[model samples]
Target: MTERQQHKRRRGAGVAAGVLCVCLAGSGCAQSGAAAEDAREGEAVQAVRSAADALVGARSSKARTSMEMATGGTRVTIRGEGVYDFRRQIGQLKVQLPQDPAGTPDQRPIMELLAPGALFMKNRGAGVPADKWVRVETRSLSDGNLVTGGATDPFAAAEVLRGARTATYVGEDEIAGTPVRHYRGTADLGIAAQDASDGNKESLAAAAKGFATDKVPFDVYLDEAGRIRKVRHRFSFVNGQMNNAVAVASTTLLYDFGAPVDVRLPDGDDIYAGKIAEE
Candidate 1:
């Protein structure tokens, strides 16, 4: 940690900045400032909805995500992917993996379990029942994707803003240096008493009472035709810890498929160790 960073405790300007950083890069089906893009909003929502529904039915996904997590001033980088075995009826949403697979280093696991319940986590082991995993997947009011953890899940968050007294569209901004439009709102999503990546799973269950199903602030950006371009959430008492995901400094649309994002299945022989996704 940098000298300036080490001094920051759980609550500080540093914390606010980190939370703002996350909101900006967050997700939604919104497309802003363009006639052509606005015309496509309806199509975009349908596409996302269909894809999400298909995923629940078929059980698999293939894609790459570059993730950066910053707490106070500490930031970590990781590559993420989602893989599932239909035959086994199981899915693994990997939030982090090494860019260099050759080293085959013994690394920690980032698996979110969304089947049968809600949870969030990283660095967990294998063979635990899927329901026990730490991850939550639900229909996003923004752009539906089996969102893993954090404020990614849509409905879980939207409900928090239900009948929110104060709401408004701010200007535009950036996250992690990426550009985006901004929206702002307020509500009361409770607190968390534990670390999402660590700590007891039961505590998480109680903590989620606020996180997974409570009230909080939200900022949603729509592209041209009110298509959710990006979404941000701010909640407190989460895990009884500091809260973020509230203010949207930026709204970025990560993926857009005129159609479905089909997941390519792996061949039996090709599914060996060290064999990640291949084009």
Candidate 2:
């Protein structure tokens, strides 16, 4: 070969080597990315497990809960702050009630205390005695009722965590100005607490509409201590009983672990003495 031809051949060989090296580097990067993703997934699972364990071991906590529901042109929202006792499955939450648009300006917001077998409601409105607590016996309420059942049970947290099937670290977030790690996963609906009241389960099922029943998605945030800071769930329902299945979404935040919760059953005088009191 001529000298010029030989030089061109060597330049072509050098270009091929450079291309090969580039391809190899790209492959290494791809592998590293996959490994990092796997590590993040594993970390998510461990974080969730740790939070679940902490919830199971905790005695009590201060909790805030909010749920928004939309069905058939109607929208409803319930928000509350309370003290929850995990061991007893009972709590005293001050639930906030919607204001009456046409009601008097002097009307005060409603608050309720939910305990096992009984509920103490305040500000139930006119015709009901003022400054008195209306205690409703839970046994008379149907299984589909909210507070009448175990809606406030702390064990529900365990149920949520345990039901997670495949979890992945989504990213980091902050709740109430505190930094937290967020993990998202698909939940096993069959493992949801069957012993809980239908109202509670219904809320969960309602959020799963249009999604696979076996794999309802849920998100949980944990603090540095591996304690759950917040949990969010969305699902939809298709029930024959309603005009159409409703879409439901719920969020729960937990803090002040092991905090003292002063929960008391209603006093005899505080209970409405009437034969039939509206709850």
Candidate 3:
């Protein structure tokens, strides 16, 4: 070939080689990026699954709870404040029911004691004397006490994260002025029941069977110590009275780690055993 022709061929070959190199590099980088994303997702799932254990490591915390039920264009919210001892799996809450449709307070706040397998309530209305406490087995409740209690047990709420089937880190946020990492995911109640602690396993299993769907969607925030600062779970169940499904959102906020919490169960004599009236 002539010199100029050979030079032109050489230039074409160089250009083709450079293009091939760039293409190969781009493919490698794309694969690496995907692998990194997978690793991040795995880490997030592991972090959420272990958040409940982190609460136990903290021992105790003061908690605030809210449960909102919406049906037929009406929304009612129940609020509670309490302290929980994660290690002992016990706590106490003062739960306030919403006002009646007339917007007048009809009853006093109920004092609740949460234990391993039982729930105790004072000021529980419906023809029961305020002085007598009513004891209910958590396992016997169809909603597993998650909704029936008006407020979810803080420790139990955290335990729900143990069943996180999929989780995505949703960036950072603050709860009550403390910095936290947010995560969103869905948890299988059946899976959560299987992984839950002995105290909560049966109750969660009951909830798994009672709820409209086994999957519960949740949003959770964790502190630097990996302890859950705030968690919200969405649950749906058929409301017998309404004869329809009710959507309930339960939120638990935990703070003041290592807080002093003392919970004493009611004595047998203090618990009312007569036929209880239903509201």
**Candidate No. with top TM-score:** 3
Put down candidate 2 lDDT per residue, 15-120, tens digits, no spaces. 9999999999999999999999888777776677567567647777888877676644667576778787765656776666544345635346456675544557
Clashing pairs in 3: none
Q: Is candidate 1 or candidate 3 better by TM-score?
A: 3
Error of 2 at 231 (Å): 1.5
- lDDT for model 1 comes to 0.38
TM-score of each: 0.37, 0.63, 0.91
Position 226, candidate 1: lDDT: 33
Q: 1-279, model 3: which lDDT tens digit per residue?
A: 699999999999999999999999999999999999889888998999999999999999999999998756889899999899999999999999888887786569999999987899999988788899999999998888989999998877988888999999999999989999999999998999999999999999999999888799999999999999999999999897876878999999999999999788888899998888776
Scored against the true structure, residue 271 in model 3 reaches a CA lDDT of 93
Q: What is the Cα-based TM-score of model 3? A: 0.91
Number of backbone collisions per candidate: 29, 9, 0
- How do these models rank on lDDT, best leading? 3, 2, 1
RMSD of model 2, in Å?
6.5
Off by over 4 Å in 2: 2-18, 87-152, 166-171, 191-212, 261-279
Q: Tell me the tens digit of each residue's lDDT in model 1 across 1-279.
A: 676665775458778988887776452323233555545544443332222233233333333344344545545445554543222233344565443335667466565433223334434444433233323323221112212242233222222333243454466666434454555655433321121112222333343453444444556544433333345554333222554442211111322312233333333342222322222
Ranked candidates (TM-score, high to low) = 3, 2, 1
Better of 1 and 2 by lDDT: 2
lDDT against the true structure, each candidate: 0.38, 0.63, 0.92
Q: Residue 14: error of model 3 in Å?
A: 7.1
